[model samples]
Target: MTQPQGALLVGSIAFDDAERTMRTAATELGGLLRRIPDGEVGPRFHWIMFQPDVLGQAEGIERVGEERIPLRMLDARPLRVADGVDPREIRFPELGYARAARESYALFRRLREEGVIAPGMRFQVSLPTPLAVVGAFFPPEQRAAIEPAYREAMSREVEEILAAVPHEDLAVQWDLAVEFQIIEELPGGVAAWWDGAWAGVVERAAWGVDLVPHDVEVGLHLCYGDVAEKHFVEPRDAGNLVRFANAIADAARRVPAWVHLPVPIERDDDAFFSPLADLRLPEETELYLGLVHREDGAEGAQRRIAAAQRVVPRFGVATECGIGRAPAGTTEGILRTHAEVAAPW
Candidate 1:
């Protein structure tokens, strides 16, 4: 196994989402948060953005239909909208995701070229899945209809990104939160949706790999949610973990990708590491462990990393989830501390 000289984060970046919230205040807060977490650190850092708006722009597409997509939590009958309504008339916000990718790449290149990072450093870019992108922007009714087109567009955007960034120096993380849910509800009905809709992302992302010049790190990250403790995180058992891990392993076979999971923050170490202790990883893939807790400080981060090292070797470190919703000062401190610990020996 190849040990990372420094950290490659799969968590939140400092940038605020323009479509979701006003950037000015959030950016300020995010900046402040980064400073403390950073600990004026080691092991160069690459702040990753989970920006779907960037993905949307890269594709050159839009959702042009009117429909209220039913949420898993909502009443299906009442939420359903009339069919045949032209979606073009609805004022869906235009998210310039492609432009964002272009700019993001430019900024990274500038940082690398301008002596901001020492030679032999790496930067990682992470984009959320199509389901996440659509769920955040379009109404529930429009999600299924809008997702297919958006995914096709996402592939194009990723290609353009590969053209600009140094493949070996870059890593792409595909965030899939659906895997956890697919298990518990599989024997029920959610598996049908997973089969029909959720599965396409794995293939599309793998296809995105072909667009690259080769040697670029492409990873798949599966999580429960952004921040909220909803249906997915509620007291999972060993059986649930086994199912999720099995499904993920299946996906890994088809795609040349790394798999990531949060450490056992909520569960005991025995419960968390026992099953995975002997699991075989793909020859070229990595098993990224999300080692830092969201609310943990420097001490907490240190303790978590030590505990993680005790159980899992040759693992990548990451946050419990995206820190987009977290204040800047806190996230920065966490990130910086992580980079320092992950620095080469």
Candidate 2:
């Protein structure tokens, strides 16, 4: 297996300006990263929460909100299920991901020519899994019926991306916070709307791998839900992440090009990474451990690196989750921390 020598960005950079984000990432850490995101900017952080709006606009869905709870917890109904909505006949009124990615890649290409971004770095687009949308917006009973339509709509977004962007210069990542919610089944935590089974979640994610063309770089960001910049369930250890990642890798026909896992801020200890010893990834897959934290900086990253080395010989570094929702003014320091702990590619 090829060992990673640098850091990876888990998308959603804080920079609201797409062009500026690309410039900074390329000039500062281009060598360290093979992929760069469009920086889930402006409305994206909260856009997924408003997916009910999109579903409501669709022909066969109804958006109904809970009167008692906060406005974010929407309960979308599949009118088509009651009205015989064929999954193939269903189509979303809008596909946001494709539109955003196309806009960003234009900036990335311009930067590459301007000598800011290096040649051949793929544009990374992180997408919430269709299951995540189904789980977050619809009520438990409606999820099973709603998922097929949502998945088909999500597939259309991917299709549009592939048509617009070059396969060689594109990377698609399935952001997977909701899967962890299912895996852990936390008390009072967000519950999975599907048949709450570990294997089912893994299978769905692997099927997502199949959604992307094999030639396009495919990756998975295994995460605990990162709402308000905090994990829904802080991982007690890497065991669940290890188990889930291996399942996706095993089930995926086209092995993932990379898989990222989180590490708790305080877990710079052997016990946290011991499960990594059982991790079975394909030789070409890169493993990125999210161990770098702003609080500990370089010294803390070194501690996590040391602990991780005891179980797995080598891996790359990243922050535990996207830095966009983090406190303002901390993004640059966090980016620099990755540089401090690991060398550039």
Best by the TM-score measure? 2
Model 1 misplacement above 4 A: 1-6, 15-82, 85-95, 134-146, 184-213, 228-257, 302-311, 339-345
| Model 1 score (lDDT) | 0.47
CA lDDT of every candidate: 0.47, 0.81
Question: For candidate 1, what's the RMSD?
Answer: 8.6
Compared to the true structure, candidate 1 yields what TM-score?
A: 0.64
Residue lDDT tens for model 2, 1-345: 233377888988888788878887877787898899877876575536556655677776654643323343433332333356654566776658888898988998888788887788899999999888877766676777678778888998999999989999999999988878878888865566546488789889998999998899999998886667677878889999999988888898898999999988889788889999999999989999998887888888888888888898878999888887777898888888887777677
After superposition on all C-alphas, the RMSD of every candidate to the true structure, in Å, is 8.6, 3.3
Candidate 1, 1-345: lDDT as tens digits: 233233435545444432112122123222211111111011111121223223323323343334533332221121111255443323223233344545555554555476544344444556655555555445555656655655665666677667766666566666666444443443332232334443554454444444444476666666665544123454253344434444545554344356666654554445555566555556656656665565655456556555555555666566655555455556557556555455442
